[model samples]
Target: MKQFCQTCLAGLMSVFVMFGFSISEEVQAEETGQTAYVDVSVATLWSEPNETRPVDAPSIGNPVDMWEWTTGMSYEQKLWLVGNLQTQALYGQEVTILEEQGDWVKVAVHGQPTPKNDLGYPAWMPKSQLANDASFSTLKDIKEFAQVTDPTAWLFEDKHRSDKFKEISFNTRLPVVAETKDAILVATPSDGKKWMSPDAVSIYSSQEDIEKPDGQNLVDTGLKFLGLPYLWAGTSGFGFDCSGFTHTIFKAHGITIPRDSSVQATHGTPVERDDLQKGDLLFFAYNEGEGRVHHVGMYMGNGKMIHSPNTASTVEIIDVFESDYYSSEYAGARRYID
Candidate 1:
């Protein structure tokens, strides 16, 4: 990736700033230190709105919605566990990190964000690395998460877990790198490297891992609807706005994210376009008036994104920085599950 001027890359000007990449369908061999864990916690529910208290509060039983990590702090790793069983997640909702009190979280969710709640991301994740002796499963046998439901909201199920809440699942994973220096567990061997020692925990969750599957088709399947139609505050399949489309995609993949384009920027770890991974989100503030994001898209790897533009625009795929529309509106780039 060619370098762009830092000053020019700020604000909407960054939108037009262009870069190019080449993506492939090859699954590289194993290497050491290739694992990670997404440190996920249920968003704390608010009791009341102090507005001035910094954090927003929710009514009783509202259920805290969406999963959040600091910029560069949270990431979903892509681990090739069990032949080809892998998972990719995008937070498909609105989240606002509160300031103080509940201020650490900003919450606006169409669905619930906890395991006990009816609406949550439920999947079977592996607690250990792939079997060194097992052969890779045929792609035909691997099942995509969405095939299991409609109006899908993420919820976890512990098929291998007898502990009820503690599930033993084995899928590819990512890490929250914003808060830490290295990636976490449930890793695959990259290149020729050996497994990395666990950093800060005894157990890890692959659901929080970054979104890099073993094949290009995974990313392709996640971003197939690059340009559909932009709807205002839309969270459905037929018509979706920029943030709406992005939030929904990640939801199907089993990760809850902030809703609005601006607030969504605050979740996950921060990464430059040059270092972006698939399923990561990109944000733009064509008009940085509210200190928020007006336009957003999903980083489908390579140089393309899946997003919904304005009322006059169609949900489609376009060069991130190639058009003046995004160029002039470009905000900073962020990676939630990277």
Candidate 2:
């Protein structure tokens, strides 16, 4: 009887091993809850799922027309987007599904940390913009990854790069399947597979494999987007908000920060205004730096800082004390990189 029991136990262990069952994986899955990957090039998250207006249709569509969406909006309509839009998730970015509404799903976007949720920054996005396929979900397990390093890169349907697939934003990471001399084959969430030019992405064995860039590196990266339009809640190369610009720049260098300016103000190493260094975040608050944090910019030394100012302005570099509003509302500074 003992010998038979031992044989059965050994057989069960073999089966478990063969099926790739593990306690750690099970725990991780449970902790993660239901998850989905962003299927579009960039999915805009909203404060309210169904409250979007007709003007927002272009942005919510599968192939989002960001250029049209931003340029088509009037100044008043653009201002309306300030509090309505929460943030954006890039293609293949994993989000934990918190709840599901009629045609929308509430997801906590990973990488964009916030105090609103323990999982991540909470927001609502259309269900169609996300992929819950087993194949797509398994991409998190892949060790090799291709992280978009350029401001924007085109994913191609063919390795020759003739057929355009999608234009992915910077810092968008996808599972790398294979690589040719000049093109890399990557697995997309909804699309079967796509090819990207080697110049557009930096290959990494894992997230940890990405080298940490210095302060000057961050400033240089921000310089690439000079004059890019400012979009409320925007995080992509298409446009950027105050915090989003800082967040995306740091993310490209393998550093993740909070999604909102107010939340971001609380973290990182605090630096004095007089000792501001290159790449340090400069914050502005209401009530002349006494109230809530509202804006952020990257210090570029010599009293200059690059920032996405407001709905009316584009990303630009200016002296720290140039604007009367910013000068009066200069909150403080924070340093993420050593």
Candidate 3:
């Protein structure tokens, strides 16, 4: 009987190994280190634990045609063009530390997942980027939080329009102290309570705001980012990717959309290309009418669309049907608002 039982146990262990279910709760706990929140308003998530290579450095998988584009650009322009593939973690963003070495830490960032990492959008951020503040872990302690609606906002020293200090990017969350007629009082990322123009902010007192997605207001708010640089995976006016641009714009209006173009394509009711209206999201893929969406933009009426295009470009208005690239690649559209 003992010999028979030992053989059965070995068979069961083999089954477990074959299916790849070896990690137990204790093992998982041992692998996962500390949980931390992003300490600053924004932190860059790098592809590797090391510092990002200089913008002018040759990219590993870059297309052969891009060599000309890279050489024609100046060093400063190349620097601006770089870092589009990296994503950003916002203030109070939660992440789990997986491994640490020296000053860099590998973390699984929480939010709309990206295709970059199977382990919940894994990336490397500097150790100084994380915070263990009790405030982040306990949201009930916060009375209210101000959501930045503008592409970029400034906290003025006073409401009288003199002496401005800190500048915050879009989609940043800050705790609100008071609400006045013209301004909302909130703690600046670097300073104490300060007044910011009410027009540039949306105050959320309750969690029901998600039920009300203001598409018109979202489109109007997105217009403020015109002429801003295009940063890959950016969700702020400091820079923005196509989906990040749309996501932050809708977030300002209390509608939370996914963080990538492919996922955003699956959201909302599908709209016919001819029926495209302001605030409608347009998607594009390389295969003309079929295939995975790789880009997104907001329709601006009269055959025009607003988007961040790609690297070496800024947020700009384009004739959607007039541009061969967009016209040929146009996949479809969707309406998320009433």
**Any runs in candidate 1 off by more than 4 Å, and if so which?**
1-218, 287-291
Root-mean-square deviation of every model: 20.5, 12.2, 9.8
TM-score of 3: 0.73
Ranking by lDDT: 2, 3, 1
lDDT against the true structure, each candidate:
0.38, 0.88, 0.69
What would the TM-score be for candidate 2 when compared with the true structure?
A: 0.89
Q: Order the numbered candidates by TM-score, best leading.
A: 2, 3, 1
Which 10 consecutive residues of model 3 have the lowest summed lDDT?
A: 56-65
Give one digit per residue, the lDDT tens place, for model 1 in 1-338. Answer: 11233333333332433443322213111123221222121222222222111121111112322211111111221111111211122221122222222212222232323332233322222112112211111111231111212222222222222222211111222222212233221211111111222332222233333343332433554454545444344444333556656665564455666655666787778887677777667788646423566677876666777667765566667777777677677676776553
The residue-by-residue lDDT of candidate 2 on 229-326, one tens digit each, is 89999999888999999999998888888998998899999999888899999999999999999999999999899999999999999988877878
Q: Please identify which of the two predictions, 1 or 2, would achieve the higher TM-score against the true structure.
A: 2
How many residue pairs clash in all the candidates, one count each?
A: 73, 0, 1
Best by TM-score: 2
Q: How far does residue 15 in candidate 3 sit from its true spot (Å)?
A: 19
Off by more than 4 A, model 3: 1-34, 54-84, 113-120, 139-141, 155-166, 179-199
